[model samples]
Target chain A: MADRGKALALPVTLLLVFEIWARSAHLHSDSLAPPSAVLAALWSAFADGAILTATRDTLMSAFAGLFLGGSIGLALGILLGLLQPVDRLMEVTIEAIRPIPSIALLPIALIALGFGYRMEIAIVSFACIWPVLILARAAVREIEPRLMEVARALKLSPADRVRKIVIPAALPRIFVAFRLAAGIALIVAVTVEIAINPIGLGAAIMAAQQGLQADLMLAYLIWIGLIGFGLNAGLNLMQGRLFGRAALVRDRT
Target chain B: MTRPVIYWRIVSFVVAAAFVGLWQLIANLKLVSPVFLPGPDRAWASLVRGFTAGDLASKLLGTLEHMVYGWFLASVAGIALGALIGSSRTARSYVAPSLEFLRPLPVSAIIPVAIAMFGLTQTMALFVISFGAIWPMLLATIHGFAAVEPRLYEVARSLQMSRLAVIFKIALPSAAPDILAGMRLSLTVALILSVVCEILAGLDGLGHSVLLSARAFRSADLFAGVILLGVIGYLTSLMMSFAEARLLGYRRGVL
Candidate 1:
């Protein structure tokens, strides 16, 4: 009975119903193309090199921003976490600025950098940095002082202590922050590209929408979704493989 | 070192001031075109003018309305669903995977579908914002409820408390922190999504105004809109934090 009930679950049922609706309603190609038509459109878009260039451009900008922003955020977070004066000095200002959505910086970025990859990259980096910085700082602050004391007792240098005690202790949370930041980076990247009308997947989707090619737009949307899902899934898998035991240990403590 | 810390604060202030002051200097120097990057003074003047002329207010109100409506609906729905799922392990097993799948999908990716389904209207904007806002609330609620002590549940069950009563009396109080954190996240996402939807869909809001100013090369007005968005976002977060502190005062007793 339990198996039967589980087999008739909500998502599967919804999917089946949606498929039937798609078949029956005959959704319009220009505005509301069916999923089947969207899949075909996706194939055609991929075959034509439209998907390739756009995907590459989008990924490149996102990756560049992610690396730049994540590294800076991690370094700063650790620095502030270690230094009480720095944390105290920066706390209020960071709090004030942090709430301002990175999208709000679009106009300034555009004015300073112009409407291209540079502007998109700046926006993505700004958006991705804050959450990661916050998480990393918190993770650092949460590190047990006893570990640091033990390292000091052993006459370990600052660098060695950081490497052996701080990094390993903070690594799990940092990775979690990275996972969160990756999702945010991708989202901001796509949105910035779309808003800026750059030559990327976002641009393609906007173009298709403007041209009233719903099928093509839907295809682009699906591709972006798949990319986001793939990244997130990959991160989740990595977390399970690397830090799964650490997470359990932390929980127990 | 203490002086350097003070100096660093001063330097940060100077850095921010110099950024604006340099803009004024550059504008005066005509190092580049004023059409692209207007001075701070001009931007402030334009902001005042735009507000006095009621251009800024209307657009701000439009965005605010959508954000409030969308965020309200998302929170209510998210809390309800999260509670339902949190109450039962079977429900969690069934829904958690699907929620996880959907949670990571960029909200922007769904805008095209939303626009297709709802058209380029307030509904589309609301739909997009709500979709983005819901995840944080849902996840927070799940975390909050899951964090509830098992002993409390056992006590409730032994007392033969009604399920609803148990949830209200035991589950909710335990989960309040997680729920508040979730709401804070949702609030930020809602604001971001509201602005993005307005910009991309060409809807009537501060985002659209920013895009309009940019296209017209009205750099001051563009900056003004950005400033307004920043102010609104900052205020919203402040308000949320204050509310959380006030409402969760009881939790300090437990700790």
Candidate 2:
């Protein structure tokens, strides 16, 4: 732990110096509020419930998209993987469309879905789905043929084979894909919210910036960083627990 | 399996064609507002106009400049730092935790800080792109270098190779694949960040152009920009993949 603290010293020192200077300088007219000012602004925003509401809305859009898009992507990926016909039919089109950044679709989505939570959720979902689907499909296709043959030889029921063999085999890669998708989802959610000026943390940051409330904007920015950090850490922990067990099982086998 | 593959190919093509055809039909039928869903023809015309006018080229060039610089810097720094840390257990243990702490901070989240520090200048855009590109490159380099077979090091030591010689001769080659993979990851991310920064900061690039068109309600122009951005992204990824294949063809042959 002492060594770990020493390891972190550089980054922490840099951040501390930056915060102090920015605060002391009263940089960018108060719009670039110092760390202390940001904290005060954060307290005020919290008291006013604006921060809470915005956070809730952002989280709602993020998780809703994650669930909806993740499910669809997994199903489509499985279909594409298991059925060669589906893969051939859809691969080119998916590839063509997949390269388009999710943000690029925002204007059309805005026009079609209008400016609201639904639009935000749809865009986030669309963005999140592709990576998960692509990874899942690849994982499925890569499953060893011998494993499938063993299941068949054992006279394992189709459902049993799918549930026991297919899912477990795909789980590790799927989780890896999910890690990537999760980052993309958070990014898309924030960007969509910022672009659309929706009632979320993203919007609050924009509003603060526009209002030249540098401190408030900085506070919101810090909150976003914290949220992203927490989510990644949580996911990393979950991945270790789940995939570690799977890895252990494989080792035993 | 062969029959299924053929069937899937046919189905996928049909589905894709049908989807595009439906868009064309819907636009012609006026089923949706042209403002919302411009047809391919309109988008194509706008794309041609943008290209002919030289605006597209300039904007693309602008975006590409920042992306290339940022990516190049990130790759070099990541590899060097990764090598340093990977060479020593103490360095890895000490540096790893801080890297983890910093890595999860979203590139977008830093825009506010960037704008504050650099204002609305190109520096802000470059900073954001570099930040986005750096973490992946760093992590990948570390992973690559750490995973280098110990036997290679033993061989190098047995040969009385100098530290620099060992790094260049053994460590770098062994880590090349991982470093290259990391570069690939960074490329996509750097591109995305470049676009996003341009949009938010309203810089003169494809992202800014798209946002401008969208806000102006120029659906065709917007779509044209979108399509161009997609092409750029696609082409970049293809280029990276091609390079990787060529450079790493030996590994593929080994496999």
Candidate 3:
């Protein structure tokens, strides 16, 4: 309770101060909006369902990109982790490509995919792929040698071995990787929207900015922050529930 | 073993060569519009021509300047604030919650806010970049300082070390690894945010160049801009790694 109070104290105080100042000064700047006005803006954005539609568009593209990129990364990571010859052959190529900021490909994606969900997803997925691939490859490679020995001794086929052993062992780490990728997916998706694509929360914020609706823009900004916070908290909870102490313990080690 | 390793090296070369070969073939065959999928030769030529004749050099320098300035500002502020909060348990208790609440904010969301505040200027980009890039370093610094061994504090107490001296001498050294790691992440964040801001604001940077080229349907120039950005990313990261190794060299064998 005390901790909660401590946490709320700073933000609440700041908000109150701003509210008083804005009200007293009758600030008319396009950028400055009172807390009350922002709240009203938020309530209206929600009431009319504009924010809802924007949220849906953003989440849809983010999830689609995450799913597409995560699967590819997982498959490729497992292949590279399991196959020494292939890993060796691909190492140079991977290293060479890895440092390129995914945002730099925004133009290429724009050129090929045009403006819409496809363009946004293409960029997000490109951003999302690296973390999952790097972490998943590491996770797979770090699996206990005894597990592989057991699989071999049982004469499990490669497919079954991977399905039954490799995945289960590496899953917790892979999930962590997914969490990381999911964050990137949202970030890249918003970035794509803010840059050019005319869909999603980012676009909403931009629209609000262009319209000089500072209150609405601030409302959208707060909403995006809330969405990011909620996504991270929800994923962290899921990770804790699914993997429990095992993942937590290993992570610290 | 050596033979297979050599063979793998040979295979790696072939694979890379094949990729370029395939791209060239596709371009030659006009599988995709040259406007959309320019050949590697064209991209390379464009890159060379850009540095030699175009304003690409200036754009590159602009981006580097923006990224470095933002990163430097973030580092200074992050370290100062992090130290202030990290040194006091009460301060951490009060501040950490707010920091946690703020940290998960999608950094790009602030771009619009900055634009509203600064009206699409270089100052807006600087503000957004610094704001976005500060979190990692701030958190890392706090963690590093807070996690310092109690025994060190005891020793410092025995030595009658001043508060500032203790922080500067003991805490800072112990926190170097985490702080360095944070700075590295912050640098990358700064670079990405700088690019995003430049693209949105139509600033004089590689990002703006790429956006303009793409809009003009100059695929070769667009590709060249992207390659230059990638090269910058690669070189900066390489430099960071070298710096990390140098600073953390003593801890290498110990770890």
User: Best candidate, DockQ-wise?
Assistant: 3
User: Chain B, candidate 1: TM?
Assistant: 0.91
Ranking by DockQ: 3, 2, 1
Once superposed on the true structure, which residue ranges of model 2 sit more than 4 Å away at CA? A15-48, A142-176, A210-216, A247-253, B1-15, B158-160
For residue A77, give model 1's deviation from the true position in Å: 2.1
Per-residue alpha-carbon lDDT of model 1 for B1-255, expressed as tens digits?
689677777766665666668779998898978887778798899889988975789998988987888899999999988999988878876777677667777787777667767878888898888888899889878777878889999999899999899778998888888888889888888888888888877888998888788878788898788878888898988899999999998778878
The complex in candidate 1 yields a DockQ of: 0.39
lDDT of 2 by residue, B1-255 (tens): 699667767787889988888889999999988988899889999999999975988998878887888899888888888888877778887778788777776667766667767878888888878877888778877777788888998998899999888778887888888778788879877877788778777788888888778878899998998898788779988998999889888987777
Candidate 1 vs candidate 2: the lDDT winner is: 1
Q: Write the per-residue lDDT of candidate 3 for residues B136-186, one digit (tens) a residue.
A: 989988988999999999999999999999899988889999998889888
Q: What docking grade does candidate 1 earn?
A: acceptable
**lDDT by residue for model 1 over A15-54, one digit each (tens)?**
6777679789765555677667788999999899999999
Once superposed on the true structure, which residue ranges of model 1 sit more than 4 Å away at CA?
A1-9, A25-34, A142-169, A211-216, A247-253, B1-36
Q: After superposition, how far is residue B32 of candidate 3 from its true place, in Å?
A: 2.2
Worst 10 residues of 1 chain B by lDDT: B11-20
Top TM-score model: 3
- How far does residue B172 in candidate 2 sit from its true spot (Å)? 2.3
TM-score (C-alpha, index-matched) for candidate 1: 0.85
